[model samples]
Target: MSYVDFSSDAFIAAFFLYCFAFLFYVVTIAGKKWSNRDPIKHEQRWSRISFVTSTLGLIAHLTFFFTRWIGSGQIPTSNMYEFITFLGMAIMIAFTIVYAIYRKPLLGMFALPLVVLVVAYASVFPQEVQPLIPALSSIWLKVHVTTAALGEAFFAVGFAAGLMYLLRVVDFKQTSKEAKRDQFWVEFSLYTIVLVIGFIAIVFIFRGAGYQATFTQENVTIDSKGVDHSSTDTAEYTLPPIVKPYNSTADHMDSFLGMDKPLFEAPSWMKGVNAGRKLNTVIWSVIAGSILYGLIRLLFRKRIGAVIHPLMGDIDPDDLDEISYRAIAIGFPVFTLGALIFAMIWANIAWGRFWGWDPKEVWALISWLYYSAYLHFRLSRGWQGKRSSWLAVIGFVVILFTLVGVNLVIAGLHSYAGV
Candidate 1:
């Protein structure tokens, strides 16, 4: 097999290993109350097993990265698929670091799933290796993308810990106005996560079934000589189109559940790279996520938060809060180095400017500022516990928008990475 093929196998192995690790971690927590086993010994044994499995998974992921790098003759972070996979691996590394510091096996229960979800989401994009464009062919590409992803990975761990703290501390049975508000938001956060999973699920389902739709759209570009040029490009869809591209018609669409045509054309103002398809994806995610959430609610017969909060009975909320804080604190400076400083240096080298108001750049700045305020509130303003956890949680949402949302919704210098 070629090195790329071997890397593909390694990637699959890593994904399965992560899934097994997540299950073992779940057993470490959920099987503690079993009839035949000592709870403390059971947790210790299973936690060790889970940690080993996750570490092996990380090793396999590393093998995939290096092998792919060797095969492609370029670092794999130039595109969405490779970058998200790398992000998943970085999250595992961050998780290992925090797990070592805290020796908390339960953290694996939260962290491994995030890794699995991220890796799975990476599969939603095309996975072929493509030649790097002139803009990305720099040594700084390695430094900037890897460091930034590593920093974001730490924030992801902080998010997991902060979320765990919330589940541990929040009163599930309270009915007062403030308590209700808290409950609603916690559930909403979970629902949002479910939406991402739903999106990945729907995409793979259609892709595996060989579903496809194609459209031809006209493009207009201005030349360096200030001339208008027109061209036609093909747009393809894996999911049935609810909304077609603006100023375009379908070349062909496979009938899905008897829906063979697009229901609407995207608005002219919504122009962006794959704007209509992205909007369709968002719509499908909400639809699938709501259905999945409803099913889970039916199975549990309670709010998802209430279902999870009980499992957190033995965990200390204060430790979780501190873990969240320290992880973010460690990540903040690294993010500044990667996302801002190294990024600016690379931008100057490539674009002959230190900064441009690209959507990705703006959002990166927003993420930096957001986390800066997070640290300020945590340290200078004396925010701790729930308030601090909330910041960590929301900070990750901002980071996600910077990483994924900006690429999906806006066309800019970074648009090539979206491919």
Candidate 2:
């Protein structure tokens, strides 16, 4: 089969392997009440199977990526869709490294599903071969994109660990068995609701901002003095200006239209709609995040102990913290090299200059800076435990903005991901 066909087949196999692994994990987590009286035996069996299946899936995933590279003759991250897939693979590799050191298979239970989700999302985009645009054909493309993605993967893992950590911190001893089961559902439900409401609110705010489009037109007219007057008509274009999700700017729009002199200019009022959309997205995200936190508290009746339980009897919070910190320590430098330095080099090569302040690039820099501060806060000032965990969470938030939010809400050159 051709490489493209082979890649597609590999994705299919990886999907099934991931699904099986996910099922095994679920069985292990919920097998306590099964016909087999020995939960420990079942857990052991399932964990073993999960590890094997996950490993197999990872292999297939890697093959798929490699085959695509061979087929395309370029780095995998030529588009937003490809970047998400790359991020998923990076996360899995990061998780594998963590697993190798700490032997924590449970983290895979959370992480594998995420990888599956990303891969599934990528499946929706067109997989056809497209030559790299002039801007993307550079060695920095690989280094910058890969490193940024690696950082995001690390941050993503950190987010999962943080959630797990938060759950461990909340005391669940006061609750009955049924309530304990309900606790997980409650937290997830609250999170989902906040996500939905916040999304709607953002849409409302942007719609309310009165987005407009401008068009430029050139007309030749004869004046009363019998002289020919060549005047450009700058009228607002009725159509909504096509603003990329991440790279919207007056300058970009001006440059985009430079080649096609205005038959008519778009209205001035519509020029800032893209910025309005971005502001709305940020506002909504904050609001949603706050509401989600509030709901978690409300669901537990304002008692911290009621919301979470300690780590599994065998695992210590300190150890979990250490594992998490170590992952960041290793992942951070790679992230810095790839996302910042390499990206800058690539941008310079592709765009004829180094820094454009594009939304994606800005967010990448922001993420890098945030993680740098995180490391400094932890190592220099000796911050640890809750403080360190919170920093990790914030660092991941910056990474999320760099990955998903930047593509979805901000208008920039990187907005091609159909976010």
Candidate 3:
């Protein structure tokens, strides 16, 4: 097989290995209570096995990265698919480093699934390697994207550990108003994660089924000469359309679940030709996520947090909090250097400006300032445990919005990265 094909195979192998490692980590925790098992020996043996499996997966992932670079003759971070897969790989690297230091099996249980989810999400984007545009043809692309992703990977680990801290410490059985509010937000956070999974799952489901719809959208523009220009663009959808593009007509739509056409037109305020499609996707994701969450709730007959809380009873909340803090602390300076400093340097070379106030740049600043505040609150204000954990968790969300939401929802210089 060709190197690119081999790289694809390696990626598949890595994905399965990560999944197996997650299963083994789950066994390490759950099997401790099994009859006829020595809990200590069982935990030790299974944790070791899981860690080895995860390490092998990371190796396979690295093989994919290098081989793809060889085949493509370029670093793979120029596009959404490549960058996200690289992010997943970076997360694994970060997880492996933290796991070695802490030797905590529970970390694998959370971190591996996150790696799996992220890699899976990356798979939804197109994977063919494309040549970088002139704006992206720079050594700084490698430095900025790779370093920024590595830093984000550490934040991802921090988020996982912080989430674990919450699960371990949150009072699931409490009935008071304050406790109930905490319970709601924790459950909501878990639910939001499920939404992401649901989004990925639904996307692949329709894509595999070869579902498609087409729309013709018209655009009108006013030039400096006071002349109106009109143009047409095609909008396509793999999922059934719940909403159609603004000022557009369906070229063709395959009937889905007895619905032959969109139920509504996109809001006029949504300007892009693809805005309707993106909005439709968001709606579908919510639907799929709600259904998935409902099934899980039904299966357990308890809030998801309550179910996970029992598994975390033996874990140390203090250790989880420390791990979360340390991971973010290590990541903060690296993020500052990559997402801001190197980015500005690259920006100057590409656009002749170091600071453009583009949506992406603005959000990147927001993420930096947020993390700066996180560190300040952590070190100066003496926030620890729940407060620090919450900051870590929320900080990752801000990073994600900076990475994804800005690309999808806002048009700017970074729109090239959007799917």
Candidate 4:
């Protein structure tokens, strides 16, 4: 089989491994009675198991992509699916680094499921092998896409850690009688897992059974005046018959193939509208992510920190905050160079224009500016702890929208994502 096929299978396997790790981590969190052990010993044993499983899963994830690169003879960011997979890999690597430094395996209890969700979401996009379009055939493709993905990955890790940090702060135990902090954490963790998995399933369903494509064959018709008008002038197209399938890959590929070209077509007047749409996608993702976070807290009848109280018992909040900031500090410059400078250079080479104000380019600048403001606030405004943590969280959402959501939902020059 081709590298694409191999990478597909590997992604599927890594996804399930992450799911298994998530389940194991949950069992560990619930302790011996629910997880089957004495509380203290069970907690320790479960921590070890969670760490090992997550490490193995990360290794599998890296191997999957490396093999994909070898198979495809190029970096994996050729399309939305590849970009998401690459982004997930970067997130996993970042999480592993944080885990190694802080010895905080509990973070994986939240992070791995996210990685799985994104990879699975990516799977919903068409996975077929297609030659790179002329515009994308450049060495800068590697530098731009890979660096942007890595930057987003680090931000994703920061967001996960920040959420955990928020949960650690609010003292949910002090907030309500009905809410025990540990109970809240366990419940929220599970809920987040469900939501992530559910979103991926929704995308899969939409691509598979929820939408149809209709293509009218190229045709022409002549008028009574013998004008020699082609049928294409009057031909009408209708939605194709819906195909139901347990798996989305085949259906998505069929739909994509049936369409003669890319999913988006921009009018001349809207030449740069794709860039605006990208900004909108990024903005909306941040809004949606914040709302989802609020809903999770509401469902538990407590604040976020209350849910993860047990994990914070021996851990210092200051340390967690430092780790969160440090990760962003390292990731920000890399993100700026990759998502902005490299992208502009590549765009200039391919389209003969570097700063076109295209939606993708504009949103990328927005992300760069937002993070720059974050750093400025940190240094000049003395933004630290909860305030800085919130910025990190917000910055990540912007980075995500700039990376994945923009390519998936927006029509732009970067529409080469083949969504």
Candidate 2 C-alpha lDDT tens digits along 1-419: 88878987987898789888877776666554463668677777877888889889889988888998898888668876677777878888888778777776556656777677667656544677667877777777777788778867877777656555545554455477765654555366336435645554444444455434443444456889999986543433222333222222232233223432223222444333344334444445566656756766787675333433432444467766776688788888888888778877887777777799999888877777788888898889998876777677667767766776777666688776533
List, residue by residue over 112-213, the lDDT tens digit for candidate 1: 999999999999989999999999999998999999999999999999999999989889999999889989999999999999988999998999999999
- Scored against the true structure, residue 414 in model 3 reaches a CA lDDT of 91
Deviation in Å, model 3, residue 186 alpha carbon: 0.3
As for lDDT, the candidate ahead, 3 or 4, is 3
Runs of candidate 1 with Cα error greater than 4 angstroms are 219-229
- Residue 272 CA displacement from its true place in model 3, Å: 1.0
Instruction: Looking at model 2, report the run of 10 residues with the lowest lDDT sum.
Output: 243-252
lDDT of each: 0.93, 0.66, 0.94, 0.68
Local error of candidate 2 at 27, Å? 2.8
Judging by TM-score, tell me the better candidate of 1 and 4: 1
Q: Which residue segments of model 2 deviate by more than 4 Å?
A: 32-41, 172-314, 416-419
Enumerate clash totals for all models, in the order shown.
Answer: 0, 28, 0, 17
Candidate of highest lDDT:
3
Model 2 TM:
0.69
Alpha carbon RMSD to native, model 3: 0.8
Q: State model 3's lDDT.
A: 0.94
Which consecutive 10 residues in model 1 have the weakest lDDT in total? 269-278
